[model samples]
Target chain A: GQQVMQIPQYQHVQEGEDFTTYCNSSTTLSNIQWYKQRPGGHPVFLIQLVKSGEVKKQKRLTFQFGEAKKNSSLHITATQTTDVGTYFCAGKKHSGYALNFGKGTSLLVTP
Target chain B: EADIYQTPRYLVIGTGKKITLECSQTMGHDKMYWYQQDPGMELHLIHYSYGVNSTEKGDLSSESTVSRIRTEHFPLTLESARPSHTSQYLCASTRGGSGNTIYFGEGSWLTVV
Candidate 1:
C-alpha cells in the first residue's frame, strides 16, 4: 500500500505573506497532482508534476517535484484572503493507477 | 469542467437504515473512484472501478459496497448504516490520458443518527 503524507496539517498567515506545503510518498510515484478545496466546496484540480526535479509556476504559485519523484511541494508567494483552503497532493502509483492522497495542508490567511 | 454528478447531496437517516449514494460521469472516463472525508480531515480512498464490471476496494476498509454495471454509473450502498458512517462521500473520474487531473463531484454529505 502507498501512503502520501503532507506536512503542516494546518497553517495560518497574514495577507501578503508566503506559504508552503510539502508532500512525501512512501514509494516512488508515476506522477503527482495537487488539488484545492474551498471552505465548503469540492476539491478542484490545481496542477500536476511528473518529471523528476520539475518545477512549474502558475502566477505567484510554484510547484516542485523532488528529484526522486517521491516528494512534491507547493509554494505560494504573497498569500491573499482568497488563498484560504486545504491543499492536497495525490500520488499516482505505478501498480494500479490508483491515487494515494496526502492528508492535506489547510491554509488560513488573515487580513 | 467535468460532468460528474451525485444525487442526494445531503442525507440524514437513522441507524440500521439502508442507503445508496448515486454517482455518474459523462466524461467517457474509464477510471472512477470514491473517497470519504470528515470535516477538516483528510480524504480517504474507499472504493474505485477501472471500467464496467470492474470494482475494487481502496486503501480504506469501508462497510459500503459499490457496483459498476455501466460506463457512466457507479453507485455505493450501505445495507445497514451506522452512526459511524456519517461523513462526506466524493465521487471522481479520470480520463487516464493527456492530463491526469481527477474531476470530483459535488459530494454527498451523510449524517447517521
Candidate 2:
C-alpha cells in the first residue's frame, strides 16, 4: 500500500509571513497534485507537477517536486488572511490510476 | 463554475434510517470518486468508479455502498445510519489522465442522531 505523509499538521502565522508544507510518499509517484480547501468548502485543485525536480509557481505560491519523485513541497510567500485553509498533496504511483492524498496541513493566518 | 454537484448539502436523520447521497457531474468524465472527510481532517476515499457499471472500493473501508449505473451519476447509499456516520461526503470527477485535475462538488454534510 502506498502512503503519503505531510509535515506540520497545523500552522499559524501572521500576515506577510511565509509558510511551507512538505509531503512525502512511501513510493515513487508518476505525478503529484496540490489542492486547497477553504474553511467550509470543498477541495480545489491548485497545480500539478509531473517531471522530476520540477518547479512551478502561481503568484506567491511555489511548488516543487523532488528529483526522486517521492516528495513535494508547497511554499507560500507573504501569507494573507485569504490563505487560511488546508493544503493537501495527492500522489499517483507509477502506472497507477488512483491518487493517494496526504493528511493535509491546516494553515491559519492572523492579520 | 465546477460541473460537479451534490444534493442535500446538509442532512440530519435519526438512527436506523436509510439515506442516499446523490452526486452528479456534467463533465462526461469516466472517472468519479466519493470521499468522506471530518471537520478539518483528511479526505478518505470511500469509493470510486472508472466508468459506467465499474465501481471499486478505495483504500478506506466504508459502510456505505455506491452504484454507478450512468457515467454522470454516482450515488452512495447508507442502509442504516448511525451517529458515527456524521461527516461530510464529497463527490469528485476527473478526465482520467496523468496529472489531470480533479474537480470536487460542494459536499454533503450528514448527521445521524
List the DockQ of the predictions in order: 0.68, 0.91
How is the predicted docking of candidate 1 categorized under the CAPRI scheme? medium
Where in model 1 is the C-alpha error above 4 Å?
A: B97-99
Clashing pairs in 1: none
lDDT of 2 by residue, A1-111 (tens): 899999989999999999999999989999999999999999999999999999999999999999999999999999999999999999999888778999999999999
Query: What is the lDDT of every predicted structure here?
Result: 0.94, 0.96
lDDT of 2 by residue, B1-113 (tens): 78999998999999999999999999999999999999999999999999999999998899999999999999999999999999999999998978789999999999999
- DockQ (C-alpha) of model 2? 0.91
Interface RMSD of candidate 1? 1.7
Model 1: per-residue Cα lDDT over B1-113, one tens digit each:
87999998999999999999999999998999999999899999899998999999998899999999999999999999999999999999998764488999999999999
Candidate 2: residue B83 Cα off by (Å): 0.6
